[model samples]
Target: MGAATGSATPRIVIAGGGLAGLSLALALKRALADGIDVTMCDPALKRDPHGDKRSYAIAAAARRMLTALGVWDRVAERAQPILDMVITDSRLQDPVRPTFLTFAGEVDGNEPFAHMVTAGDLTAVLLEACRTAGVDLRPEGVKGFSIQGSRTDVTLTDGAVLPAALLVAADGGRSRLREQAGIGWISWPYRQSGIVATIAHERDHEGRAVEHFLPSGPFAILPLKAVLQADGTLQHRCSIVWTERAENVPTLLESHPEDLLVELERRFGLQLGKLAFETKPQAFPLSFGVARSFVAERLALLGDAAHVIHPIAGQGLNLGLHDAAALAEIITDVMRLGLDPGAADVLDGYERARRTDITAMGVVTDGLNRLFSNDVLPVRLIRDLGLGLVDRMPGLKRFFIREAAGLTRQEAPRLLRGETL
Candidate 1:
């Protein structure tokens, strides 16, 4: 198969409709010529907000990317900007939760370093934008695909075949397509599991996020906006990601609600006042996996499909958004230059642009998780001192804040800089 002739637009098929796939479709629609065709496929109709009771920390660059794609206004309505990030290291029962380090949580012009966004809200906005952009939204999974010279034939779960110049696998970390393509990945299974839930509190979070480094893992309390309760009153709410040893996650998940609340309160601290469950608790196994390569013949990987890293830094979604923006940029450039979208050169460029950042983040998150997820005295002392020192250095603090905010300012996609891709 080759490029379709007779006025048929160049087709690009993106599998998986999560943040990466949806954002890529929107970005491409905005950047590529109107003659280009984009189709996004997922097994489900929509990613329901209530399905996952977790929120994401969207960095400034990723937020700008959303703005460029025209989805942030809707997202901002429910989004909670993180004004500060406080870090502490202590046991769950420690009498004092001393602040070892803090980040101002702002970039230039006082822009928030990140915002806490629910997966549902983000997906809803992106899905609407894709629809408005004339994207072909398919509610079918990609069962399998075969790549031939200059084209890819994709078979849907319903046995429908769709041909496209390029096929992208954004099917998440355990990407079946990636495996089907025989792409090998290095996997490191952490003995930890992340327990995600939403909580109603008696006090406001004041736009601050907290990360408490416990022996088992890092417990992050991300801020969220007040939600209306059934009693006709607004209640303060927050999303909590409690990382515990893999062995203990079962007990934590099986505990009674009241009993679970007690344990939550201990790790969550009284800073937020009394807490109650706003959503059912869920646990997910944590692991680090990065694909050996991000591209194969006529196929490419994005987001969790490319790399799944530790969540210690909460950059998983941010990294995925970056991928979307970058890939869209590369593909748009390829079309503008009259190059095949799925050409080896094009895919190689995309992979080269993304691999370094993804690998760096994997290493950073893995290192940070390892450094803090234990109670070794010497390691603890060294890390605590390092944190304190960084906290004391204003320039270093700003650098870290900007870096964490994804403001590297080098080869970042135009969308990430609030420009058209």
Candidate 2:
């Protein structure tokens, strides 16, 4: 059952060593041990691992998957749990923003619905785990690939070609592998940019996350773990996602540090006391995309390679992690049955398991962005009333919280359910 062929172990090559790729490699190695060979390639792996200055909101189900993969324990102290969340809608110049909806962030008893962790910390731990699990980590990415019957011949950037039972494109939204496979991408620019930065605040946040729906887009203030300063004083911090018109991003990025802080303060309010930049603000163009297919021949797409949605809900990374978990489970199940992991049936099952979930999230985020990112009088009134109504319904609010926690699916992957493959 361990061998794909009589005396041959299945070789799985993954392109892109981001969160999704690394997690998938680690999960496969840990589950199959020496029975499977997993290789991950990404040019970024050769550079400074901490160069990524982004942070992500890991949902409860994703966190459970990490724990099952032995990643959570290594970075548990660096994770900041969201105890509660508040949502409000208001104009930029409004003197006050009224909270229309609030949620207590617990899904299963004491388990937090989500946790915030910086990209550097989470990737560092996953990389270490993959290394310990004996996954072949290549600093070069897949240059291209060709499917030949039951296997894929992956060409690396270094002019090396390796044939494998499966080639997973965990590369991100602009995946070259996906393009080479002729997967049609359905995408549209939102004409907006998401500005991300870490800021120090004088007051504690008490693990509360806030989302203010402005006419431009959603402004998220997510709490981060405290950091000790050079002077030996603990500094409270929060990660902010400021969505603004794409045309305005260049000016905001080029603005003087003081001037930028002023813009931040306009929306940040004074509830957290004085705010100072802990990291330079960076902006990324926002867009919505979904691949026409998640699998082709002997290849499978994961993470941003398969889909990219607006950051309005902060579910982008979690969605990718879900892909990894689902794909890993399916591959494990097929291989344990002594079947080819790259079989048409195997890929079909993977697609069937994920396409609906991905499409639903895309629709949801797109709808939310359109519903909230406007200033029409009637639209605002209707949205506010809806929020208020949902807030008043305890059952509905709990359902949303659980959905955000990624725990609503009855057929969730084993890892998502905190179980090993």
Candidate 3:
């Protein structure tokens, strides 16, 4: 099949079934109904759906997009709203981590700027939504592809061929499809690894998140919804993203449980009473990457395939969701106009819409990582002074809060604003 040409419904083949791909598939199905066909290919879909133990902070705009796609409601009860945030700069052994900045964490009145949700929970909900929406989920991943005029022919690992009006490489930062499309990617390792884990504490976190900027990196404590123990009592919990020097991460990860807990306690403090890991800590190397272009003829890139930045700002997932929302809107509008969704002009619109935003985020995160992940006394004094100034200015803080919530963009996609296409 060659993209259902001449009055037939157009087919869109997404080359990964992670959050980005699944969300895009559901969005297209929900918006266009019988007008389009969406197929997502990924080998991970055949494995245990709840295997990922990580969590993510979903910004206000991304939550709205999920709501528009009928996903947020299903996981709303499990989502923990971040009511406030605290920032401090100090060494690991500092007797006191003086707070340099604080934020109330609201954008428009009482609406929280972000919420924390487990990857397993959110992925499960998105997968279910895609299934209910009639999205085609394939167990085999896209092995390769070839663009042929108005359509791109996708070859699955099993050798089955799929011809689509457009091909999307949501496969990730190491996207084979993107490389095959001749897209240039600029990337570099941060030489730091982020250690993630869930912690059960004696006292409730009260929806407060904290970020401690140390010489090694930023150690973030994010609030999570309460979990019920086998004894039938509710236990308070929080998720942590502990960034450390890459060279030191292996020793930490391989350390004894007691030894690891000791290191964790040093940074975690006693704000939440005693703490213990509810899940084993896992580490992932940090990096920065951006595709030279987000789209090519008959092909497009989404999520990590387009960009990957340091987790210093916790905007990676939200940025990917933004990509899904923007691309879906552009493609839907193009199809509604009786035009080719994979046409050069259509792809250009998506690029034009996302390029500036992506570049700005990459720069901000890279700068923040470099500035905060060091112990130079002068640099620390300067950054702390800057943070103190920014904190004292309510207007500037509010502007930053709105920006983090993804609310400052006037031309955002309809789904991101919680509207149906």
Candidate 4:
């Protein structure tokens, strides 16, 4: 159940089976010395089809991680590359959505800035890769755990006990393991809700993504693969992340289908042609949260467990994927040197590498949500002008694009660089 210090193959128990946990398992399985054991626990993994029917904007860095993990082949066919992006600022009733910024989405001649991938597709592929890599997938949640010298004993919800050289808490924003470890966090509920769903459009999106900043929040139109409708005809489809005031979201969610479409059309515009719901809409309350520390003894937090930011930039998942690669790289490097994977200094290295990036992203997303989610004329004018100025400066625009693509940092993990661990 556990590895002896500095000798036996180390055992790593990850307490979540979402993208973060699975990716971590796969990364470790590929990087660690042979015989190392990786186990992931989450009841949801038992579901035949995982995910809530939403799409994610996968940054270039994340795509590289998927490629290095050898799962991108399965994900690539279904992925929709975002070849361009248009940013605008206007009210819902405005006759025009003025483009204040535009980006040519390719980072290099070969790579696009990002791709739109359904959550289900990505998770299924990652899970299969984890299985192929020999990760022990447990269909039980982690109830809690206790850290002893050189070993951590985990308690599963089914009352089973397991031991590992290191315990990872990837259980998400409301991580029970994190709370049990007494990790403090900073959190604030935004008075907004992100309404998500897929819609069929009359015209092709041609791989362009759009973000319209409104008084309530940002409405993002992300491209998705065409799907066969009930009539057996292939229809163009797109994903929508429509943010509205928190108080107004409930009413919107409860509104009649016809009425909801009217409101949607108000913000969505007719740029992509007529739109109809391809899937029922869902709403998630928006919030900003960051754990005070990313590591605790034999445990480390990943993904939403460590930080949760506004959906304005769609960088949440990418950040967690980065954490998985970084942590895996750090642990495997030390282990290759005959050092303990759970050594305090090894964990400290992971924290030092990720904390700054996480904090910077949190600040950027929070500032964007505040600056653009208001109706004040002066503020709007200033931000719009700033956006326009950035758009005009090719060098500055490219810099921002590279940052969003997750390539600006020089000390990133191997997977982020499209290299194997």
Candidate 5:
């Protein structure tokens, strides 16, 4: 890419400095360096310090992306690799419950199911990455934007206006910039809220991830590794994502913590010993959402602004980060070819490349949510049989596992390969 003389850096304005937004900025700046000007606008200088503790099941590919961006070393300690995964059905009263497929991380290659890390840790590393990469991370909220012929003009809440050849919206599910760009989205409530909290258990997790399908929704217990307490006793940290129906939020949050832990223990079984209580309960509504289009004029959508899905599969953040990777590649190619980075023609290429994957994941996750969250006898039998069938077919089982881990046919972003830009 040519650095066309004085004061001519292809400008990019990123909105929302959360995991997705900050990551996009860091990745772009690292990839483009001074060839382009990167500015990230986020008002929240400090993260939600007292916020509900939650973790992300970032795929192996996402870890690669972070490594390339120079953020993984800081985040590695906070994450535990998922060495195994189990999907099953049935309860204690019944002895002959169906056994679903079990996937081992090392089945196909030296790949793991996913790495579990808290949201707080993810943000910290990304912020550091931005600082080191010299990304102009502006801490101001976005208010509105206008489409200029060759650029997009963004108005921040603090009465500052900036012009950029490209505008990327990582502002999350309810994106104000996406709306101001006249980008319509397709969204609906899923009648469920994901209740996220950390729990300390008596038994060691042994780097295992478990997802149980209950009547309410999928309950995911992700491992956070064993810690030695001050008394020298082993305590395991795990993030529990309890997707409950919206109507049951109040009752569940207000319910006794001990009783809730007991119920969770019963549902999870004895693989891990007795589960203990930790942290107050929290809840969030679950919804399967996606945007209608990804590109418009000089503006583009990335991360949550592009799509959202049921956390049952734990690929929400992975998908968002993947989008960031693809978009950066496309834009970099355009710059290399001596074309406008935000050209509509180039943006169309990006949209075309990602649309299929985004739509496919949306359908797959939504379908899985419906399939597992129901109690129909026929549905149960079919899924159980299907699960067992996949288990027997090692090839198909490994294929599905690899796909979930974001190790697939697509050309990996440099980060996934652990290469620094």
Candidate 6:
């Protein structure tokens, strides 16, 4: 029941209109001249309630990408730059249980490592840009997909079949279109759940972010600017990314708001004031997932569809944004040059350029997760030593800070270099 993309302006079909999908559409529309066509399918975006629960820690490069797409300034008010990040162990019984770590953000130059922005604020700005650029927004989700001799046929939940030069699968993990295209993913559950919530504090955050290492996972406190209540009362706000064991997640969510805040306060220490304003809490199972291949005959997997890493580094969304920016650049350039948008050469080039970065990040994040999540004595000794050495070595620490900010050297795209609109 879908409309076939006629020999129109190199029509690119994107599925899943969350951050990655929408951002890709907006970025492509801006980068491509001559009315490049884009279509995105997402159903849940318009119906999101209590959008306050979702947020992200976007790297400096990701912010630059948004600025190039003309969406950053629109949502800047809701974002808080991370002035500093402090890491330490969660051993109260053994005070020095190898407790040590490094600090990023502000340590380099005047710039913070990244900005923490809520998903709703980001999506609102992206959606507006997509509309202004005349990109087609499909309300129905992708239900199925098929590959013909030279084309890809995408079926939506509405029963419409649409043809595309390239089928982009941005649907989250467990994508139906990826499976329909016969693409398989490699995933391992960490037996962890990410408990996300927003808390109002009595003291100013000073734009500092904190990450605490515990047996469960990292407990991250991300600063956010003051929030305006319905009645116009200003409140200091910060987001908590608390990772807990899967079995314990249910109990934690069921815990009374007061008791949960108390536990968080105790675990978080008194550096910041006590947590007061508690929003509704939600949790999702955590895992490390990567699709073996990023592309097929006419289908390409992106965002969570391609890889999912630990929340410890808060790189999951940043990685997803990177995928969006990279794919958009490659696809738009090839199409503008009058080449086949989904040609084997073009797609292969993209695959080759992205593989190295994706693999390296996946390995680094996985290694960090394994190292920090475990409480083994040897790991404690080695990681603590590693942390201390890295902390003292300014050069090595700067290298990591640069890497974390997505400024590492590579043949990065122009937009990836923090291009401003």
Residues 37-134 of candidate 1: C-alpha lDDT, one tens digit per residue:
99888966554644655699999999999998888998998999999999999877789989999988789988999999888888888888888888
User: Which 10-residue span in candidate 6 carries the lowest summed lDDT?
Assistant: 1-10
Per-model TM against the reference = 0.97, 0.98, 0.98, 0.97, 0.93, 0.93
Worst 10 residues of 4 by lDDT: 1-10
Clashing pairs in 2: none
Worst window of 10 by summed lDDT in candidate 3? 1-10
Model 1 residue runs over 4 Å out of place are: 1-7, 46-50, 229-232
CA lDDT scores, all candidates in order: 0.89, 0.93, 0.93, 0.90, 0.78, 0.79
Residue by residue across 1-421, what tens digits does model 2's lDDT show? 1236446788999999899989999999999999899999988888777877788999999999999998898888999999999999999999999999999999878999999999999999999999999999999978998877667889998999998999999888998889989999999999999999999999999999999999999999999999888999989999999999999999989999999999999999999999999899989999999999999988999999999999989999999999999999998888777888988788999999999999999999999999999999999999999999999999999999999999999999999999999
lDDT digits (tens) for residues 346-414 of candidate 5: 788879877888898989989998988877889888988888899999889879988987877466665
Candidate 2 has its poorest 10 consecutive residues by lDDT at 1-10
Name the TM-score of candidate 4: 0.97
Name model 6 segments beyond 4 Å from true.
1-7, 48-52, 92-99, 229-233
lDDT of 1: 0.89
Poorest lDDT segment (10 consecutive residues) of candidate 1: 1-10
Candidate 3 Cα misplacement greater than 4 A, ranges: 1-4
Backbone clash total, candidate 6: 4
Residue 253 in model 1: shift from native, Å?
1.2
Instruction: List the pairs of residues colliding in candidate 1.
Output: none
Question: Where does candidate 4 stray beyond 4 Å?
Answer: 1-7, 228-232
Candidate 3 structure quality by residue, lDDT tens digits, 331-411: 898788778888888889999999999999999999999999999999999999999999999999999999999999999
Error of 3 at 116 (Å): 0.1
1-421 per-residue lDDT for model 6 (tens digits): 1122346666688998888888888888887745577888888756652364587888888887887877788778878998877788755344443437657575346877799888878887788789888888888888877776556778888999887778888988888777766777888998989988888887788888888888778888889878787998768888989888899988877889788777777666666666774678789999888888888887788898888888888888888888887888887777656666777776777777777888888888788878888788888778878888888998887888888888885777777776632
